[model samples]
Target chain A: MPSSKKAKSVRAATLSDVGREAGVSAMAASAVLNGARTSSRISPETRERIEEAALRLQYRPNAAARALANRRMDTIGVATVFESRELNPYFLEVFNGILETAALHEQNTTVFDWQRGAAKLPGWCDGRIDGLILIAPTLTSEAAKVLPGHTPFVAIHANVELPNVVNIETDEERGAYEVVRFLISQGHKRILHVSGVAGLVGSDRRLRGYKRALASAHIGLDNALIIPAGFCSDDGYRAMRSWLQQHAGELLPHAVFCVSDGVATGCLEALSEVGLRVPDDISVAGFDDTLSARTTLPQLTTVRQPLRAMGNRAVEVLLDRIHRQNTGDKQLTEKSIVFPVALVTRASVGAPPAIKRVVPSRR
Target chain B: MPSSKKAKSVRAATLSDVGREAGVSAMAASAVLNGARTSSRISPETRERIEEAALRLQYRPNAAARALANRRMDTIGVATVFESRELNPYFLEVFNGILETAALHEQNTTVFDWQRGAAKLPGWCDGRIDGLILIAPTLTSEAAKVLPGHTPFVAIHANVELPNVVNIETDEERGAYEVVRFLISQGHKRILHVSGVAGLVGSDRRLRGYKRALASAHIGLDNALIIPAGFCSDDGYRAMRSWLQQHAGELLPHAVFCVSDGVATGCLEALSEVGLRVPDDISVAGFDDTLSARTTLPQLTTVRQPLRAMGNRAVEVLLDRIHRQNTGDKQLTEKSIVFPVALVTRASVGAPPAIKRVVPSRR
Candidate 1:
């Protein structure tokens, strides 16, 4: 072997090679090594020969063929909606967990982009994968109905009701309320909230929590302060930057509650450009303790949604349901597993200065 | 229907239902709608009845049947080593692109957990997925040889050379050398390097570039300044922090060249903890302009690896190779494609401070 090719081209041996070495039929070798059901009645001597031959040949069963015979692909499909946006870190965390657990069960994990639409999903949800995992799906009720009935499905943070699907959701309402309450405890009043898209279940839940927190504290809801910002960090930056430009000379709120860590990261950028020090001039708290939170200058004070844990748990539940759905004749179980959220205190939130009754506007 | 029952009972009508409702055999219905290759030779009247019956019965061919008959799972596998470390934003970028393109091709992508020995890979390659995409694989040479030859593999940043595999790698050497040269132009003679794992191709290539840049600038290499670090952000933080503590009061290098953006973020955190401002105190440059680069307060001056494009291209190349591999008796092609890296100038770099003379030790 040449030096350049020395370490690179190592091809694995196949079953036919084992069969030939074993002096048995390919089916006999397949039965012993690759688990072909039809070849189960092979002689003991032949089986031993096949096994020994497989060892000598270093035969590895082909993945595609195993799937063909078993009807169990041993692969989980993750259906998500991350596209042009660079906010994939959030999805990546959840996906990492899914991969971790899926691998443990000897399953391969696949991701499906639901950002396109439910129109194209029926084809994807077929015999190819054993089960499908939906992440933050915003499927229309009509389109959701088109999902294949034979396959099992698990959804994370689904916006609408998906029939026969086990929805894994975080308590976003409580998470929002907790962060807002923490901000209030720090002597902050008149807080500004940059929210996610309206009509989105997550956005509504967080907004409701914000309102509930305000009511509990006997603080009046400031309609002008609640703005619908999108999910991306860029959205947070633009939303905050625009607000600052419009409210240039106005009294700033003591704290700004961002909907997600991506938003918080963006808001920090906007603040930096305008020279507003986090927690010093104005406090910032974000929902969802994603990777973005810790990367920021003053690491964000945010609510921790167990995204990875949820992803891992979703795989376990989905796998269980898939086996039951396939082997146990369409057995349906109770739907929805809701996980609690935690408030993660970090450098972004602190006590409001005594002299500054109102926070300074970045503009 | 009550919500509980609604959630539990979503049985999909199958092709058998369509056959029964259309007053024909299941094979006849399959011949009409499932698009099986028994020939597109169904009677026009029977086809119309099958279509009508399918609509009335809401019948869809079982995905498993389609997969078994076609041997086209429409699923691809994505293997990565993300589970071992904290979620890095770098993987997110490439994964997003993979998801987007896979969706466009109507291909479902499965993620394979890469922590298992390469022995585990052959099990996955057996038949579950049509093809495999290896994301940043660090496979041992022995294990690499065990990868199944039947399944086509496309590797992104393959640490070791793989035979019969098309490895997609960024030109980190050029990027590293250019970045260091840029730093050298800023009057920084003693630039410290926080390297990745000692044996990784990326680590050695970056070290070579750093040395090449120093040589080009006529600066003597200081072995003490080059610290051993690894890929993760935490490694960078720990490496730089330990260096800072050990060299307390000594004059800092004009610039610190970090392994990747994740490492750079950790470096920033370590510097911040010590009350040292970036660029003003010492400049830092990162490789692999991942999302963390932009997320950081002082956006990283780094090298962009075109991860998203590489991911998209991987899909194209993998699909192409899969097609060629499946085209009759020809073997899979053994061609390799290398992508170039570009310098990304953000806010992290600045001119070296004039006051280089100092000796202050921490007491």
Candidate 2:
């Protein structure tokens, strides 16, 4: 998209240019134009003249000079793995909060999207950012050990315990428990649980909560009802569709509880394809009341994690740590910060029907 | 959350430390450990030993040093207004593409979120980023004039043309025309248009397209059916709901054409609240095939703007401009790059009902 003609040789206007145009010293011009802390002493008339000159000259404050003087880049780094081409709604919601808070603080946010085995994480700790926030990092203990001590870090849903990083997490087990209990209270005897990856801590916690809730009501755990699925919508769709195909003509579960809103969305689509309607033929619920939950026609009955609030809180805590480190104060030693979750009752869930429905064969 | 205890004084190991541990010169260590371009001649034995020594010392490459050595940060800046706390799906889709391309180029993406009238955009031009991408910037001519000449910039959906900056956009008029024409073909004579802000270029273009499509089909334009709304779902919901309230007992439009998918989703909710079934009662369509379109049941029939492709192209063009600037070559003179749009027919739209239904009053 470049032109063949050469660009003009004129350089951008500098502080000196503004000063010359304003008939003042560069220091006086800088004070008034760049909003330097030392500008309080400048007269109002002089300040007005400097501003006019700056506008006429189109002067821009040099960020490098400011950074060098303040010894701060005023930037925060977000490190995460972009596992797929599609944008993840979970990341979108959390990032919206991060951006909101970072904007309030007038800080820049740099995203570092790393692949699973790149292990290039250590190189990012240099002076580019004041601090780093890790999103659902699956780092091993050994990998975490090599993190640079110079930079402060905050982790959200960290899989392993880092030495000193303060991890922010939600009570997924409790969220799962409440939602499943609510379904059971609606007279749902047979419930299908589309769990996340079998071994992940978050998935396992939700499974425990589901079992605990069922046991409380004296309902035995049906091994056949528990199915393994990954986190995304495609996983939910394939898992549910295949299960329905295999159990064609068999008694269907009264309700299905998904590990994530995305999974629930897929389940809805799969159910629609199989001529079954949500909450009418079979009640369906999901976890994590993300935008997908509300986007659905019969909105999902799910657990609401305070994701945005936690994101805002992470920035505040990270900024505090950055300030402490700059002042040579002791670093944060807290192990983790936990946020509460609530049950969101929406249109997706309903009581079981008087007559049991059997799975119809897929056309 | 900082602890009161004094912190340990140990610093991160550097390349020099790894070199010393490996009994090699710093240059040799740089070649082996940092993957310097000059490292091709290094023997396998030396490379393995250097790697092991680097691992033993836990040495990580310093990004700041590399940036300083190359005199380029290898980072791109994305500036936008985060008007609301919620992440705009438009931003999300475009950003997904930006992130993908940026990752491919091994470049960092730093987001600068500014409030309206903040006007601190110039301060971001200093050395940290190679170039800049402005997302849907609405700069007045005066504001556009103040942009720094030294930094190369590419704008996506820019409202006003900036000097020497390439703007990336889509043919909204055509997209709108095609979708409206499709509705007319489906036997929808009385169609309501929920448009964006009246004066905005995008909104006006869509309006023109709707009129043109109607003219082509020999249908008279109905001023009463052209309602004003903002881009978000709340605006759509409020506008449609209020219209329904006012038009109670009046003949309903055979279909509603919304400006964006968010608005369409809101329209769906509003219609449902009034007990109107989609397609059965009235057909609905939206523009911008964002994720929200698919998330909704009976997914939206909308216009597809290649937002991700546009985002990826912006980065590529920006990178090119950055390179040309570095080489002191010619500057870009192109005013705008326009991408084509297509109609995506999904479940939300269908043939108009045989009978003209009246707007039902709320229960």
Candidate 3:
């Protein structure tokens, strides 16, 4: 039979061709060449011979051909909403970690916009990716079932638990409590908590943490102080601005804790607009020490979630599941992986002002 | 022969199956079902028959299978450096636009981390993506030659001109001149320009514009006022801080013009650290009206580059080139497309301070 090398057009070297060159069985070449789990049993000398043969043949791994063999595409899909307002500093930090780890493992990362919701997820699973990682997914249990069961999946900050999918999350409620507790320790009274959207777990969890901290400190929860704002800088600005406009002559809170860094950034802008100085007239704190946390003037005092580490672990867990499924050992014992959060004290927070200043009527 | 419906497992319907169901040749089905360029010549009745057959069979286009027919992957690879430091706000705005346009055209967008540079680009072109988009690539002309000639490419803010690739760029020099001229119009004679890296085209062009504006205004350029700094926020902060420390008690410039929004953000922090206030003590301006521009306390007065529009156009042009290349028409008449730049006047800039303030010693 004619060798593939002598074909009319030059073609990529196959496992069979590598085996033919190395004087071994096609299975032996597959183990060493594709890094299959069985490759460990192959002798070091044989592995070296296969590797040398592949190099001499200039063999490049064909993504398509490998999919035919093990049905593994060696690509991971990242699903997130990519709207203008939603693409916050949090996504950038997490994605940086995802791309870093994926590259380290010689895997490709492709992103899918989940704007159309969970219904469109199964369609994206049609052979393009080995697994998918949903970022801060807000899907119901019923909606989560739309994800195909055959593919391994992972979620970071997922609002709901999906069967068989590992969820990587931070101790956000604890983080909020710790930060607020720190604010209380700084002698702050009448603290204002600018909450996120009412229904979201991300929002409510922080709100819960705020109430718990206030109760532990023996301070009554001021229902008026808990302003329900949406996420993003614009939302925070609008919420704070409207509140200030309504109570122009009322005493300002000693400190304000915003739900996210983006919100905190907006609050700072609004405060600055109203001629209030951060940490001097009133201290400010934020959760999720994202880029926005550090970029603002006087830098925000925020809760540090190890977002990059979480992203790296998500890829590692998903890859382990993929490999286990490939080897016919597919049980995932750990359904939840939570990382601890810490307080990042920056220039944003300070001792409460000596005098309670009234909210000025104009800038 | 039995129809495909009798198959044991449900399979995606192919053009041949559609043809059989519609009682027509496979070529007719290819034209109608595949929507090939030739499909326009088919009669309305035949198209309707093919559509009905496809609906009955539940035909869905398989990405891999379609690539086999047209040698087109229907996917575009976006090559950029994804790192904690490199993942600037500039990329987020540009990427949003790319995703939006790609979704509209039904094209899949996959990201390739180009941290390894041009050496890894050819390896990525192995039958996976139809074309590639380079975002803010700093490839040398020699390095650009390594790109595979067969694949189409579109570049946004590419540092060097490639032989056949279409390059999308903004007029940074003009933006710089207009902004500096505006600063002069605001009664600022002594202006400090904190620039990006010295060798980069982006840096040099803006420098040239600054000098041109100074010369046109008959104001002699002060070599001491042009401080060389990198682009990121930290670079800007350190540069400004070091300069202020070295020039303690010296007369401060009436205005500070930063090379990018990130740099301006840092300058704001450094200025705030001292006793200086924006537009009151020293008017500050920035280039590249990115998210950092708006997120600042006093919104930045900078240049608008239309980054999203550039990203959208990059996908469009690359797709056009890919289709033309598939049809054997690969002439690229235009090598570079320059987008106009505009100045955004905001609260950052104001008239020069009434009296020159000395650089304060410390925070």
Highest DockQ: give the candidate number. 1
What TM-score would each prediction reach against the true structure? 0.86, 0.86, 0.88
Q: Which stretches of candidate 3 lie over 4 Å from their true place?
A: A1-59, A84-86, A327-330, B1-61, B84-86
DockQ of each: 0.38, 0.37, 0.28
- Compare the candidates by TM-score and give the number of the best one: 3
lDDT of 1 by residue, A1-363 (tens): 443423333455567778889887787788887664755788888989999888887676765566646667777787777764666677877887888888778777766666668876776655567888988888888878988777789999999999988899989999999999999999998889999999999999999999999899999998999988988999999998888877776777789999888888888888878777788888999988888888898999999989889989999999898877655556557688999999999999978754443324544
Which residue segments of model 1 deviate by more than 4 Å?
A1-72, A327-332, A357-363, B1-74, B103-106, B327-335, B356-363
DockQ of 1: 0.38
Error of 1 at A302 (Å): 0.8
lDDT of 3 by residue, A1-363 (tens): 744433343445777899999999878988898775788989999999999998898666655655545455678999998773745768888888888899899888888878867877877766678789999998889898777766789999998888889999988899999999999999998899999989888998899999999999999988999999988998889888888888788888999999998888899988888888988989999999877787787899999999889889999999999887666666887999999999999988999987776676484
Chain B TM-score (each prediction, in order) = 0.89, 0.88, 0.90
Model 3 achieves a DockQ score of 0.28
Angstrom error at residue B225, model 1: 2.4
Model 1 chain A worst lDDT run, 10 consecutive residues: A1-10
Docking class of 2: acceptable
lDDT of each: 0.81, 0.84, 0.85
The residue-by-residue lDDT of candidate 1 on B189-241, one tens digit each, is 77999999999888989999999999998999999989998888899889988
User: On residues A256-346, what C-alpha lDDT tens digit does candidate 2 reach at each position?
Assistant: 9999888898899888888787888899999988888988889999999988888898898898888888767745767789999999999
Query: For candidate 2, what is the lDDT?
Result: 0.84
Best by lDDT: 3
